[model samples]
Target: MTKPAYIAITQHTKNSKPALVYVPTRKHAGLTALDLCAYSSVEGGVAPFLLGSEDEMDAFTRGVQDETLKNTLKCGVGYLHQGLSELDQELVTNLFLSGRIQVCVASSTMCWGRLLPVHLVVVMGTQYYDGRENARKDYRIADLLQMMGHANRPLQDNSGKCVILCHAPRKEYYKRFLYEAFPVESNLHHFLHDRMNAEVVAGVVENKQDAVDYLTWTFMYRRLTKNPNYYNLQGVSHRHLSDHLSELVETVLNDQVWADFR
Candidate 1:
């Protein structure tokens, strides 16, 4: 899939608006934003912000010093990655919330936990962990929800802006999982399997698999009661648990934005 050049574009308005662009890397993409504004028809301006060390900011702000590429970077404008002081972080949060900054080119670290509302939170791609024995690594579903929550804020339009998923099918599939997984009352430990994941299915069940089975059946039974045509299945398995849980996801998606929020 083709990754878009820009993660998000901000619309300027009377209200101060801040935009958050989530990129996989800090240095390369942050600087690229500065370069894109030079040639592209895209409006507003792009500024780069770095999150690591302070010494790197000088060369970064100056752009590539090579004589060949110097002229191309002359028009570049954006924040550089000076280490974020606590006050600096607070200030960025405020600027973002107030919409003062037109475009913020930030590392995913900028989103470590800050919940600044924006038009869109575009996740371009992610790092993969490859070990010698096995090569499999991915972001946890809860982590993705936490990232997406930055956009699910109280909106000026009253109608919320759409959370768009582009290019990546894996990301889209996770998005659907998150939408279904949102409303349920579960903590980080529960979602991650660190804590016991239990549901009061029917009378009572104490074993983990039994609890999972009961809970899964209970959720599906509730959905079938509401709309019999939603889905049909003969049995369940660890492999297809997500497919079965999807019906509950549909109910949760429209039932409320978040039970906690309400």
Candidate 2:
């Protein structure tokens, strides 16, 4: 018997319709977008026009200092990232959503909440930069799932595809992470201090008890409580929580209060 081209479905559901397209990096995204444009032009006919007016597209093309990227845009390919101006990002996103652009080379920033119902989603890399660690690390299961969710739009198409491309060493890891449906781990502990401080500064919470009570109602709290063993936070003492809360209170109280002199 001949072997199959791809592996058998491990954990896919009827509702999970996104085709995950994974590449290695932002550079790969660009290359892949160009390749897609080339293929589409040859197989699918002329490329669609960009979303904006000719003048707007011209300005955008000129504004891009990267000559190669500018030329790519002419081929109906675009990229999205925080580095681009808000207008540029919006234009690219709109173009992709309208199907005016064949492919969009985007960073993970596009994966959050923006709804671009594309037939395919290509994840360039499985690892993202970890600011805390000052190094690139594998994406968490939640983030990987969230990115894939962007591609699976049942309203537009009953099914979509997400392709993930990773290095050979990391291929098995990606397979396990995607095929096994790993549970999402919470990062509240990493952001707890910053969140409390911001809440105190914004006047969202007044006291330590208020902070604790407020957190208890959040989804993170509920999830963590339910899976304490997996999270390993069962031993988080009240004293530690109180200390962090008290520090937040002090910082907020000490800050200069803005007032209207009038």
Candidate 3:
């Protein structure tokens, strides 16, 4: 990720256009920014990202709390994440937009939070920890798309650039999906019990029949008929639909029965 990122920074620096780098976590965001600065110096880069003098740079980074981030900024790089204060976020964001900094590294979740646009974008990694599932999981296509969007600056640059660094095994997977418009299967089943419980608490579901009826008006129900294979339906028959909904209601109610035991 740092190799490709350094290359990106080198290429864009010649044109004086800023770039954004996305990492998997807040820690990676800070470290990747620092590494990019290191790569710059090792390769005889005068910190191309730092466009201002030391006094001006110090004024720009007044209230920044993260020491590593401050150092990166001095090298003409900035970092963003949820851990930073709003004041610091706004400061870094302004630095990027005003072209004082040439690069900003951010966490995956920050893709939606900040609206920083650049001539280039490099996704450090595609996987992030899913606390709910207690495992590392691939990023949602929506979030990845949003990250890619940062590269294109409308009416400013003729074109945009993106470099995604993912595992070799998933190369083809990303290549296919990035260009193809595949149908999105319903993920309701992943947390059907929790969803059903919410509805029950809201008085929208009162009985077993009510629960099944609720599923009928869902995206899951729509996809059930279109892609029966995805939801593991044996056949697209009335009996099959009824059986599936019945099983779903049973699972949801059973979970509610044991909700507090664990």
lDDT of each: 0.43, 0.58, 0.87
Candidate 1 residue-wise lDDT, 33-141, digit = tens: 5544543324434333222233433443343433222222233223223344454445445544554344444555556656566555555455433466476455555
Q: Which residue pairs clash in candidate 1?
A: 16-99, 17-99, 18-99, 47-78, 48-79, 50-81
lDDT per residue as tens, model 3, 39-123: 8778856876787787899987767887888888999989999998888888899988998888899999999997888888889
The digit string of per-residue lDDT tens for model 2 on 1-262 reads 0001011011232332222234435555566556655654565456532334555567667766555567667766776655566766676666566555455666665566466665566566677776798998887777787877776666677776676756689989888866686566667655666676788779987875687676666666656645766545534466644454455445544442322222
Poorest 10 consecutive residues of model 1 by lDDT?
188-197
Instruction: Give the number of the best model, judged by lDDT.
Output: 3
Off by over 4 Å in 2: 1-70, 129-134, 181-262
Better of 1 and 3 by TM-score: 3
Candidate 3: where are CA atoms >4 Å away? 184-262
**Quick one: how many clashes does candidate 2 have?**
14
C-alpha lDDT (0 to 100) for residue 186 of candidate 3: 89
How do the candidates rank by lDDT, highest first?
3, 2, 1
lDDT of 3 at 9: 66
